[model samples]
Target: MQSYWNFPAAAGGTINSINNAGIETFKGNELDSLTREICQNSLDAIKDESKPVVVEFKSFKLQRNQFPQRAELLEAFNKCETTWKGKNPKSEQFIDQAKYILNEQEIPFLRISDFNTKGLEGAQTGELGSPWSSLVREAGSSNKGDSSGGSFGIGKSAPFANSKLRILFYSSQDLSDYQSHIGVANIMSFEKQPGQITLGTGYFTNNENSNAIPGLINLDPGFNREETGTDIFVSAFEPKDMNWVEAIRNSVIYNFFITIWQNKLVVKVDDEVISHENIGSFIAQLDDTNEDYRHVKNYFRLLTSEDSIQIPYPAKSYKKIGKFEEGEATLFIMKGEDLNRRVLMTRKAGMRLFEQNRISGSISFTGILIITGKHMNQVFKKMENPAHTLWEPSRFEEAPKEADTAFKDLRRFVRETVQQTFQAETTDTMDAFGLSDFLPDTTTVDGEGDDKKESLTLKIKSIAQKKKEKPKKKLKKKQRNEEFEDTLADAGIIPEGDQAGHSDEEREEGLGLGGGTGNTHGEQGPSDEGTGGAQEGKGEKEKNKPIDVEKRYVCLQKNEGLYRVNIKPEKKFEKGKLEFKVSGEQSDYILPILDVQSPDIQVISIDKNVVRFINLTGKKLKNIKVKVDYEQYCVMEVDLYEI
Candidate 1:
């Protein structure tokens, strides 16, 4: 039995001196988290498509005499304690637990086994790049592919974190050759002893030599059959003052709810089996039906079936990034439940990028978004952190250029689509959104029609009180034209035939978005608002240049009636002077406004043609009318567009 105790060591510091932070990752809601972590590993290890993975949890009480080399093991345990004490004479917590597990003849253990999949197959030791090496021998050695759910192999440390004695045994059978392997390891605090350094992690096997093999079990005799899989035995797993069974079962059903729904994994605890057969019953155990659970279910429905939670409006778009084999991404959004609003981002492989409490809102201001791309790996690979808990491009500055683009494009698309969908659903009247003015096939926002992309800026304003707008007199064509001309003049836009013009120095100073001079588009800038300004050139050339079909800006209003939406560019604002500039050339744009019909507010006239922003600039500010009686809310979406 002493020969079976083949411990694996860590580098830089002994395993005894292992950092608690690494182990702390597995310390949340013990049983629930442990079940999720372990199940994820088993799922990732699946080798045969024809067979479903099977996991079993069993606990047993054994007598001291059950050990094959009890005396030799006791001697080794004594030596381990002596060495541990020499390293850390001050700390007794780890040593005390070790003494209990080794000195006690009647110790209990918990065993979890996975069947019908590739077991931990590969070299037992000395080489890298194997599941055995990553899972049992190395910390943070994750050889999992892109599709694998476990981001870092650190998840394997979960079992040790849950064990009272921090001791675990591994026994696996290679499915291909039906060969057996076994090993034992212990996770302990870092301690140093002269010439007696203990890594705390060790392997156990029946091999006559020192090398630890993965297959030979010291006690269980029935695991060597041809069927392949791995089994983990945990020693002294009784936690203080908690019902481990119930907690473990609930956590399994909660965290793996989606996996269980797919019918790929089954978990058993003693005589009680938890699988698809009882998934619903387990879900019933939750108090609020859990938003995360609902999110997963809704996503599955959208993924497998076309049926989705419907929205009354039609301001949504479907887009794709990269031409990966995983297929294009389709985006559909609508008004959803007031709470738990989220963007359900999922991979084709069915792993959702779950960031809890990600989106926040309330009542009329709240919205839900669902985003799915079959070839999501191309985008997500660049967005994930080592923990795989959050996804953001800013998280990866050193990533490849294409990956960064995918991240930016995907984020923009999701943001624009959700804002449009929310405002569309919330508005009561189609006239408010000017929906009747545009053809059904016309693009409601930029990027709806062509591949040309625009960097978009988002600003959402929610009014707390319901303000009534009195019907206003409609402006004549001449008055509207004058207002547009005045706005351009404020931004230093000279008319095509007008003689008066700003000096060349003034023109250069105003040749960018928000009126600052320089090349802005597609270049690194001092700010995030990529230059929305046009190029400065010869006066005649600048005036005669065709409207860059790609430079259009679009705003979506709930109703055709214009509500004051003030969009302030982040840069170059001095005093009250506005510097944002848009080219003064004719272009095409759509302003779809949805205004919910309210009996208290009178109806007003609406614009019925394409609106251009060539005359619009940051200098013009629209004042919002407020009623003393109610809080007025205005939500507007601004996107750079090319017509």
Candidate 2:
């Protein structure tokens, strides 16, 4: 029996895969999505947990004739052109370019093969629920079991997203003694013949049921797959589109390092291998350099360090949701400096689903929470979004309200554990009338503690009121208020004639100002409400950009007090000054530099907190080193501004 393409005739509008939302979402992010989706599917089909699941990404340009269903596929492409040529410009344009690629000397193909997997079962019987049927024939249908990595079925579209021709071939061998292979295309809606059209989706198979061809007749060259697994051939691959080697390596290391670190997954891209043996080397190279894997090093510590303790459960409490009991989950955390303050959330199988981030409060650290036990995994698996990158309560159809609460409780348990483990203290401030500083400095009435003190402003106001109560001149309301101000001044509540100098406490709470009282705490200048001498230096705010901590950074070498700084000044500024500020918990203070040192820089002079440099009109960025007074642990945050 010969195998050929059949996009059966249709009467009316067809379901074009070109407009497929599932495939469209993965287009721009093909490299990352391809690695994630393929690895996830292989892990979900793990045939032996005792051994690592092996995946190989072989990128090669195969002979044009070696391309499966070449003639038949071109025939379909021909029909694709005629069917939608004038009606749909998108389809017409795509087919025009696709036909050019089909005739190329060598066709690019990325063959992804996985070993030690269950592969696609039910190929012999063509069962609808089989992995083979669900993957090859159906769209938006899944056969993944409980706690599987994916069930939304959109992940299958990731490979096609990388295909410019929008075509792929599926080949798999199951332990059930069946080998099945077929070609599938996701194209725009098109006509097959006059008064006949087909759906945007079509498969290269023999029968009407769209069963995959029996299998491959023989293995090619050195690539062989005797073990049970699947092979996804991405046809019409473009090497220039991306560096597949780096993409595959980084995606696995960033997203599934936990799986590899646990010795459960092994990946080979071209000839490079990434496994637990060399995983650290890969991570060390990316540490602090890659924002995507910013916390992976700390997360690795939590997994491998002896100090990392697993929280024993029902330990504090968690409200059970469905079959997930409070004790079924496990969380381990480690405290360290410079951690990204995130926790890796994953199934017991070790594939990282997503991160539960910003869990770190005063304490800096990284953590990992493994959703263990069958029942607990099921609950979280249901909560995962379509991409499996996040857990959303609304996605859990079991019970939205309860699921939301349970997820919160789960996060709280982890957060509380990290806090308790690190023992970081949060200072309790005296909040007076919702304003912590509303009540001023005071001597206790009974000479008691902080809580029993009376407000000094209120005490002075009471004394002034009592003096005003005595019979005096019958004055106007405005005069009466002026007399009160003078009375308070005489009583030493404020300065003699000072009406505009607000003390620190009064300024903070917006209460009153200092007068005859000895405290002079007027730091604020005239407001910007009017134009005059105040607006002279305020022109600095109009510059194109200000060099902040994010864009300009300093690498402090404590021994030498030399700070390596790199910054780009606003292009519009012809002159600029560099400044340094030592950041503290409460506020930042100026850090005086002893000298500015750099071969490429010429400094004019140094002001109190400013280092004025020579003309920088045309320069973009410069690497310069500055020296500060030698102090063991003093660090500075560098900033720049246009003079």
Tens-digit lDDT track for model 2 on 208-242? 77777897523234576776899888988884457
Residue runs of model 1 more than 4 Å from their true location after superposition: 7-15, 18-21, 67-77, 83-91, 123-127, 187-196, 206-210, 214-226, 289-306, 309-339, 348-353, 356-375, 378-383, 392-405, 418-643
What lDDT score belongs to each candidate, Candidate 1 first?
A: 0.48, 0.68
Clash pairs of candidate 2?
Answer: 494-515, 494-516, 495-515, 495-516, 496-516
Question: Best by lDDT, which number?
Answer: 2
For model 2, the stretches where C-alpha displacement exceeds 4 angstroms are: 217-220, 239-241, 313-320, 424-643
Tens digits of lDDT, candidate 1, 1-643: 3345544334555445434555677665567656767777787788765655788877776576764345544555565565557566533566566666766877777788888768777745435678777776677778876656666566777788777656677777765544555555454433233444456655566543334453456444433345677878777777553677776776676556556666778888777787777777666555555555555444433434443433322222223333543224555443444323445554433344453221223212222232333345535644676544556666544555555556445555554555565665556544446645543433534458566443446687875877887744421222222233334335444231212232222221222111221111221111113322223451221111111111111122213332322222222222221112223334322223333222222223111211223322332332221111112222222222221
Query: What TM-score would you give candidate 2 relative to the actual structure?
Result: 0.66
Q: Candidate 2: global Cα-lDDT?
A: 0.68
